[model samples]
Target chain A: MLGDNDGILSGAHFLDGDHACAEGAIAAGCNFVAGYPITPSTEVVERLAWRFPGTGGTFIQMEDEIASSIAIQGAVWAGAKAMTVSSGPGISLMLEHIGLAAMTEVPCVFVNVQRGGPSTGLPTLPAQADMMQARWGSHGDYEVIALVPNSPQECFDLIIHAFNLSEQYRVPVLFMMDEVIGHMTEKVVVPPRDQIKITPRRYTKLPPGEYEPYRAGDDLVPDFAKAGDGHRFHITGLTHNEKGYPVMNAECQEQLVCRLVDKIRTNVEQISFFHEDGLEDADVVVITYGISSRVTMRAIREARKKGVKVGHLRLVVVWPFPEEYIRRLAKQIEAFVVPEINLGQVVLEVERCAAGTCDVISIQHAGGAVHKPRTIYDAIVEAVR
Target chain B: MSMTPAVENPVEQLLRSERMPHIWCPGCGIGTTVNCFARAVEECVSDLDNLIIVSGIGCTGRVAGYLELDSFHTTHGRAIPFATGLKLANPKLKVVVYSGDGDLIAIGGNHFIHAARRNADITVICVNNFNYAMTGGQIGPTTPLDAVGTTSPYGVCERPFNLPFLAESCGAVYVARWTAYHVRQMTRAMCEALNKRGFSFVEVITPCPTLYERRNRLGSGLDRMQWFKENSVIKNGVDTRECDIALRQKIVCGKFVDVDRPSLLEMVEAKMASVLHRRRWERMSREQQKPIAMRPMKG
Candidate 1:
């Protein structure tokens, strides 16, 4: 489906990642945004506050990140395409609602412009430490889609995909942006409304009496029914049956949780997205995402000049982890060198996927700054050795 | 079974009948409050389809689950903000937050104050059972000083909050307090709150027989209701600051604050309209008065 034309900024402009993200959400038909100001992420909401009114959307600066996070979920249930934005400490406060969104299958977006953390370590500097936290921050067994954007353009482009994924899967989609990508300025070309593909919400077609809120079709995602649609549906954070009533038994828990996980796990092939270069004959693969992916390119160029058979695999959709693809690549490659802003997060996943079939070298950084290309170059060299 | 045409309960239509018998314990006043709420919903809300009940995690929070209207059982202390979002996202829907004292006044205190401050269009029904009965009667923000709970076995040293005072001071458009025993007055208060335009709060003081009553040796839920009936002073329009209830003290209950105020959405729309209008007028004037070269460059 085409997006609302009023929301589409169909022109080329120099924009920061944060402003681009705000435009992306508007273009994606997001009608509600609730956020609390946090450094590096405040610009996204600020732009939304300025633009939403003109686009017939609602923007609310909530009291705190906790309120901002759950407010978006409430808006989602009220039949709006909704989202919230925050940085590390704010996202930390939003963890509980992230679990709520997962359990209740509330389709919403959570944008985390990553900053150095371990308790507000660096408010204005870059880090990809939240890569692991995005997948596991919320408690219990559940699955969510996390997209990593490397540049200002990708920030605009990928956030739309994030909303679509969340709506299509009825899950909270995390758009992970680091401080550099969030603050960096570059040209962003927003396509026309008709040219942009948007996934409309899969609202249930069944009558009020027949519709079961949790009942899924062949896609394993239940069609949504909003609050005032006369469905009179009940949504709870507790383990529930198809009737949306709390069913406190192991059978129900196993069924609900497995479906919550399997819906994404089984459809990983369709959900996984990555950009690869020279992987056909390369001996070593460089695995990275977000800002590190941008840094990895420089290191890869230098390594290629040094006669190393190195390839770059940039992850766009980080969660659901592209396990099968990684496993297959592990069998073909000598080693996978993973460099990220974090100490060693996504590298753990690479190591697990490799399963000792091939070497997995982690290039760790203590955040506050992006990799010095030479650091990743050294890891690429060591992996080849 | 006497089957001379089974007479149905009128309130059953507003409740999830199959989900009952409810989880509320015997002699618990939460059930009584729910009944009063149902009556209020029936009285005030013309369109049942547009009513949404949101509750946080607590015994009273289960009100959302029991109610047949579109409902949400949210995380602990988050019902207010969640309801605020619902109301703002779709102005047609009448959102309500029903939860316990500990859920609303303690962990969710910030959200509570902010929502009231914004005058978000939603009705808040807080069931104050004095302690956290669901967690085995732990001392809470509203637990009376010198009262005994599992967490306050040595007697509570901290002063309990005057919920009506908090609601009024925080800018709630309608603020009222009632005991579970005062079903008629409580129902009327709920009806008024449900019909109010902005943030409205109704605090219902109820007995927790299993945990609170047992731990404090306060006889039973019936005895507590009897006490409420005997001790509650109906002081309409009294200052909320003078309505504090210490242990075994006279509970001042009535409609305290009722005033008109623009809701959060109302203010947002007004501000947006004025700013956008000014911007459009400025742009038009600039286009007419200045040449294209002299105009400010678009970013």
Candidate 2:
């Protein structure tokens, strides 16, 4: 328990998105952070380094992103709230351990501040190209939670949401921010300590000898025991049985991997967060998220002036993709205008959900900058025609 | 052979015996290293509850799976950083990283050096079996020069890493080396390293009888053990630079370095003490301050 303002800023302050993310981690009771300094995201840990010691938190600058990622998982298993922040290049190096966390059901946070990339793309700019990678980067069949914040305000609020989801579901929560949002400064009102809610670690009640480390209970999540609590259980990256022993057989893989996936798939509605505006009697809808959504706002208003009847669907929780809502809305709307700072990453989802029922217009930008309202406005006008 | 009395396992409490029979083969030196490690943990660490073992991927990495203490078999070459996290998160826990040569030296070498450079409060026990035995006898970072392996069938022309030298160079506070045949000495070294304050390293020259020995024509595990017994020079306090293993050469083994140094946790705590004290003072003074914490556990 944070017993004081040690973890909360608790007032309105003009700060950048990266600083807000740091505050969010502390407010969520995250006490351990291991990260390599990275552009657009380095400020997150810099802020943490200055603030953590006072809050009894530990910040380790690891040798590389690979080490940083696994280090956080280690802290998570030891009963500490932990996270890592990085950009595209670091995120690429961290893909393997992200799968390990998902496979092992370790609760932690990964904040990737999106920058341009095929390789070391743009250090100081923005891109949403990693949307697909966030869903399927690690080589495996599993699901993870990812949250996208549209502004500095949301970065503070939703990172707390990210940590809570991670704690409850026992999965890695990806806090997907972009350079545009990360460096953007705005007024963020942090709630008072008691007013904020946090999801505490669910430690198991079974006596040491009787407890099975990986056995799923009613909520489809197994209760955890911290490393030093005398429940000297074995945890591995290998596909394991309920006892957490490596079981190389297919049956164990089927059961374990399925649960890793279904736990998120089955809870899609609870995990899904999106915003809708002007949906009533609209013939066309514009779908976007992160900084792109902010840029699309002006486009939506302009299209309304042209009487395009265009609605806006802003995705707050990007992963688990809001399929059910989009699928239902696809039938009623004539077209879905998608604008993103990448080459049509999330728009593919819109196209899939629409499934030949409606026209999907993708307005793509190749990184280094956010989308312009005119580009999105043009797509809206074309989709309506 | 009958001189030693047969007895029940003394360190049985420290083993997850149900997970046995283990995946180890007869005469494989990994079992010997594991046994010595268990004995050291049994004899040295005062708090069994606080002791944890972290292993990386390899044949030797399997050691964590059988340990009764909280253990993690992490991804290849990652045990050091993972253990560093565990130690930093809860300073009360005694973190020990047990991994193999290829995992700890080749791929995870960066982490190994950095942890040592920072004097992280952890012990690293490296089992050097000459080659990557689990992956069918491939040449490893510690493979002896001119020794044959699956990948180096023509006899390895590449230079082998002097592990003790590397550890010493990386600023490890305690460094030692021993063959699996020297069980008593190995166990004693493990205990000493366990008791050390900062980064300590123990290199066990174990035989991979199944793969390494068969490929290199080193006869049986018995012959390898007999050869090491005859060839090893226990030169205590010898310089680590001369400890490198060449093909069928006299292997120098001993505790090379032992000194006191501040650990990563200590340094970090010292650096942050003032800031933390200030926050505590602010907390005590503030009338409206409340702890930002998660909800309490439900009964």
Candidate 3:
């Protein structure tokens, strides 16, 4: 289906990643947003605050990150496409609610404009350190889709995909943007409303009495019923059965948790998005995501200039970590070099996938800044040697 | 054999009886409060489908699950903010936050005070059993002085919150206090709160028989109810500042604050309407003959 015309800007305009994200969410029919102001990520909510009222949307500045996180789920249950935005510290505070969103299968977006942090280390600086935390920070086992957009234009484009994937899978989709990308200004072309495709929420066609909220179809995704729909459905953080009633047993847990993980894990081919280059005849592949992916481009150029056969693979969807693709490439390539702002997070995944088939080289940074192209170029040269 | 039809309970329509027997223990006063809440729903809410019950993690948080409504049992201390989101998003749903004192006032204290200050349109029913009853009676924000619990075995030394006072000071439009012993009055207060348009709070003092009553040697749940019957003072217009509960002391309970004000959503809507109107007027003036300096007149 086409996006609503009211939300489409439909023109060329200079926009930062944060503002582009707001416009993207609006274009995706996001009617509600609850957020707390944090550096780098605060502009997303600010733009929404200024723009939502005009578009017949609701934007609330919640009390804290925790409130901001859970409030979006509430809005989701109330039959709106909702989201919350924060930085690392705020995302840390929001982890519990992320788990809640996962447990109850609430379709919502959580935007984290990445910052350098173990705890408030550098609020206004860029880092890709949260790559692992976005997948595993929330307690218990569940799957979520995470997207990384390197430019302002992709930020405008991919956030709409983020919302659609969330609605399709009934899972929390993470919009992972670094401070550099979030703050970078560029011209973003928003197409006409009819040109933009949107995935409408899968509301059940079953009658209220016939609907069992947790009963999944063959696709392993259940239909959704909104509040005040006379469904009178109950959802909880506890392990529940098909009727959405709490059932405290291992069998119920196994059934529910396994499906939660399998829905995205089995659909990785459909959900995974990446940009590949020069893999046809390259001895070495440089794998990266987020801002690091952009830096990898510069390093790859330098490596090519040095007469080294270096391939580039940029992860657009980071979580559900492109393991199968990496494994296939690991066999074909001699080595894989990973350059990230963090100290060897995504490198671990590369090493696990490479699994002795190829040597994995990690160019680590403790992250107040991005990796210099020189460092990555050296890593690429060493990997091929 | 002669056939006899089953006589359904009066409030059975509002409950998920298939999920029963409930988890609340014998002699637990939480069920009594639920009865009053059910009665209030029966009397006040005409559109049952539009009512949403949200609760945080605790003994009282189970209220959402047992009620046959569009309900959510959310994370600990988060029911208010969740309800705030629900109410703001739809504006037609009558949202309610039902949880324990520890869930609403301690871990959720920041959200509680802020939601009241914002005047979000939701009703908060905080079941105060003097401690964290769900977690085996740990010390909590509402645990009275000298109360003995697992965490406060030596006796609670810190000052506890006067919840009615806290609610009133934080700008709750409707504030009331009632005990499980005062079911009729509690039901009336819940009805009033349900009908109110802004943030409304009702603090129900109930007995946590397994942990609070046994640990404090308060005999049993029946004895606690007897104590409430004798000690509770009915003061309808009394100041909220005097409604604090102490160790085995006279409990003052009543309706304290009731006022009318525009809610958070209402204020947001009005502001947005005015801004959009002014912008539209400005756009018209710029395209027509009016000067750019001219402003729209205030009502």
Question: What C-alpha lDDT values do all the predictions have?
Answer: 0.90, 0.89, 0.90
Clashes of each: 0, 3, 0
Cα displacement (Å) at residue A29, model 3: 1.2
Deviation of model 2 at B109, angstroms:
0.4
The residue-by-residue lDDT of candidate 3 on A122-232, one tens digit each, is: 998999999999999999999999999999999989999999999999999999999999999999999988888899999999998999999999999999999999999
lDDT score, candidate 3, position B282:
50
* Selected candidate, larger DockQ, 1 vs 3: 3
Badly placed stretches (over 4 Å) of model 3 are A1-5, B1-7, B278-299
Please provide, for model 1 over B163-205, each residue's C-alpha lDDT reduced to its tens digit, 9 standing for 90 to 100: 9999999999999999989999999899888878789999999
Question: For residue A31, what is the lDDT in candidate 2?
Answer: 90
- Name every residue pair that clashes in candidate 2: A2-B291, A3-B291, A4-B291
Docking level of model 3: medium
lDDT of 3 by residue, B218-299 (tens): 8799998999999999898789889878888899998988899888866775676577767753553343221012111112
At residue A277, what lDDT does model 2 achieve? Answer: 94
Q: Identify the CAPRI category of the predicted complex in candidate 2.
A: medium
Candidate 2, position B55, lDDT: 99
Cα lDDT tens digits for candidate 2, B77-192: 99999999988777778889999999999999999999999999899999999888778889988899889999988998889899889999988999999998999989989988
Instruction: Provide the TM-score for each candidate, comma-separated.
Output: 0.95, 0.95, 0.96
lDDT digits (tens) for residues A210-301 of candidate 1: 99999987778998999988999899999999989999999999999999999999999999999999899999999988889888899999
